[model samples]
Structures are given as structure tokens and as C-alpha cells.
Target: MKQLFYFGLAQAKACIFPIIIFLTLAVTKIIDIPFLHRYDLILLVCIITQMLMLALKLETMDELKVIGVFHLIGLALEIYKVHMGSWSYPEEAFTKFLGVPLYSGFMYASVASYMCQAWRRLDLKLVKWPPTWIVMFLSAAIYFNFYTHHFILDFRWLLKLLTIILFYHTFVYFTVRKRTYAKPLSLSFILIGFFIWVAENIATFLGAWSYPNQQRQWEIVHFGKVSSWLLLVIVSFLIVAMLKHLKQTKGNLH
Candidate 1:
């Protein structure tokens, strides 16, 4: 029970920035700020919060680097997606480019931040990990499909199959109170994807961004998005895995 509590606590600690951002956005609708736009306020709050986390030693410099990479990657995707009419930020803000608030990139950084923190807190290790080149290739292909699907055939299903084949033998080892537990890496991807899907629902409900269907009336985001999240989680995982040098060796933990 104590182990479980600590495990939960670690997860909560990882999510601190995202939860705070979500709550702040939710309240912005209710509170009338005379001069500041909601989007600008959100940007300010997210930046200050990130600085505080670093200053307080809640996040390390190395972790900040990983988060920074995600921010840029996310921002690039946001520009492409918004251009392709994927979804939209339906608000006016000076910090926005092509309708995406600069702060929107931080949302993706939050996922990377959580993954980095959780890996350290849980002492995670990878077993039977695929080769780096293959993982990188697949990650690139997966990201490319997100954009090319609009112009060409969507290969998400095929890519997902490749992901399962590549990682089927991979295992994630994590510690809880000095007792280590292992799970299939694919399962971890799915579980994380599901949780992100839930978070997405909450984000949409809070008016962070909205789909065309959502603009008419709020409804549950289609379940198919979970697949997209699962792929994204795999992408995030690979980047962190590479950064941490988590490669499988012949002498495996048993």
C-alpha cells in the first residue's frame, strides 16, 4: 500500500504542470481579466511555472532539454496540423501563429516531462529493446503519416502493426519499493495512450482546442484518437529511451 501511494504520488508530481495549466485555463473562462487575453495569460503562466519547476529542482536540466525538444517538435506538428485543418485553437491571441498559441507547444512538452520524471522515479529499464535505427525510422514514418495522410493514403494502421511487431518482445522493468515489476512495452504504450486520451477529453472540455464537431457542441472525442495517442506515446518513449541510453543487452534482468 505504501508503495502504491508513492507510485501514485510520483505520477501526480510528474503531472503538476499540466494539471495546473488545465485548471488555470478552466478558470479563465469564469474570471474576466480586463487587459490580458486568455491565451496570453496561459502562455505567461506556463512559462513561469516551468521556470519555477527548474529553480525548485523539481525538474533537472537534462529533463529540460528533452522537454525543449518536444516543445519544438510539437510546435512543428501543430503548425502542419492546423494548416491541414486537423483542429484549431479558436481564440485570438498576440502570441499565436496561424491560430496556434505559442504556449500550445508546452502541452506536448508536458508529456515528455512526465515520461522523463516517471522513468527516473520508477527506475525504468528496457529489455529486448529494438535497435536504435529501426526505432528512429519508425518514429519518423509515424510522424510523417500524420501529415501525409491528408495527401496520400493513411498508413497509420500499417505503422501500428509495425510498432507491435517491433516492440512485441520488448519489456519495461520498473521498481516499486525495491521490488521490480516488468510489463510488455506495448502495453505501456496503450495504457499511456488511454490516459492521454482521457486528458485530451479534459483539455477539450476546458476549451484548450476544439475539433470541428466540437465547435458545434461538445461531445466525447472519437475513440479512434487513442490509436494516434498510442503512436505518439511510442514516439515520446523512443526519444527518452535514446537519451537515457536504454539498450537491451545479452545479460538480461530476470
Candidate 2:
């Protein structure tokens, strides 16, 4: 039974790369197909099912507690942001469970699990504290400046900013040790992320994925695009680096 579970896990992991490639091709219109939304929904369902299987096999009860807490925190932040108009979701895509969509909770839980995985892979002790601090600072600036629609009032913005800072600090506190065995920050990942962000923003502007509250001056919202580029670069690099580290570590163990 244990072997079967692991075998399934391996198969699922193998599928991820192809799934990403397929999605990317479809999104870019290189595939020239309809039913994009249906495919997206299928992907989401698959991801949720995969996470459930992982929960049953990989995570402990205590880890589940942490995941639950992070999910709640992320959901709250998303709700607050959406209510303030930072980013609006399509009503068709979400279920309003607590005046917020069920998808928000799912996103939160997924992010928490992902971050935990990253935390386990990198050893932060080798990296200087400055870069980590700067990353947190950038996270704050990005959250407050670009995502400000989540807080229309200055006071509310400040509160949200504080919450973001607290979350960043908490995440860092838990994940810092992994930073020690840092690998070279991959430029390829950063470039790919930047291009993806740019493409998404362009699609958004073209009404492919709407950002209802993004305001333009002179019919151009370059600032948002730039910030998106930055966010994606940082996020993608971190995620890829961690995944690579995990792969290498596992190979070493084998």
C-alpha cells in the first residue's frame, strides 16, 4: 500500500511539468483552442485532488495545523484586498463561503504548503540576512503600493501593510534556516517570470483576464505591469530554486 501511494505520488509529480507546459501553450494561444475555461477548471480540480492525496500521505497532523493557519491568514488577506478592489475575481469562479470565495481559501492553503516545501529545501544560514530583509521590504512595498486597492483609506492601508509585514516576518522566522544552503538565483527563472507577467498584463489589458480596478493614465498602466514583472521575478526564482534544491537533495539521498 505504501509503495503504491509513493508510486502514485511520483506519477503526479511527473505530470506537473507537462501540465505546466500545456497550460502555458494553451494560454499563449499557440495551441489555438477553445474550452480554455473548462481546461482551467479541470486543472484546478486536479490540483485540489492532488493536494488531498498529498495530505493523506506526506503531511503530519501538526503540519496540517500550520497549513490550516496559513490558509486562514491568506484567505483573510485576500478577502480584505478584494473587498477594497485590489483584484476582483470573476463571480463564476468562486463560491462565497464567508463573504469570500472558496477559491481564496484553496489558494491560501496551496501557497502555505508550497512555502513549507521551499522552507525544507534551502538552507538560509549561508546567505546574508540583508537579501532576506530586502525581499521582505520589497514584498511590503509591492503589497502596499500595487495592491493598495485592498485598502482605500490610508488607515486601512496601514493596517493591511502591517499585516503583510507580520506575515512576511513570520514566514521568514520559520524558513530562515533553509536559506543557508542557497543555490545561485536562477536568471532563467527570473526572465521567464518577467515575460509571463508581461504576457498576463497584456492579456489583462486585452480583456482576456480582467483587472477591473487597474486605472490607466494616458491609456497606459505601465506601473502595474512593471510591478507585476518584479513580483513574478522574485516569486518564480524562489519557487524554482527551492524545487531544484529538493530535487538535488533527493537525488543525493538516493
Top-scoring candidate (lDDT): 1
Best by TM-score: 1
Mind sharing the TM-score for model 2? 0.42
lDDT of 1 by residue, 1-254 (tens): 88889888878977888888888888997896879888899999989999999999989998899999999999999999998888999988889987799999999999998998899888998988889899999999998888898989999999999999999999999997898989999999999999999999988888889988999888889999999999888899899888786433323443
* lDDT minimum window of 10 residues, candidate 1: 245-254
lDDT of 1 at 96: 97
Query: To one decimal, what is the Cα RMSD in angstroms of model 2 from the true structure?
Result: 10.9
Q: Which pairs clash inside model 1? A: none
User: Candidate 2, residues 1-254: lDDT per residue as tens digits?
Assistant: 65445534543453342344335435544443354443355346535654664666554454455557645655676677666665554434334543455544544354444434434432222232224454555445544553554345433335334434533422222222222212333332334345546555554454332355553311334554544444534443343334444566688999
Q: Cα deviation in Å at residue 134, candidate 1?
A: 0.7
Error of 2 at 31 (Å): 16
lDDT of 2 at 186: 33
Q: Residue 99, candidate 2: how far off, in angstroms?
A: 6.1
Q: How many clashes does each candidate structure show, in the order listed?
A: 0, 11
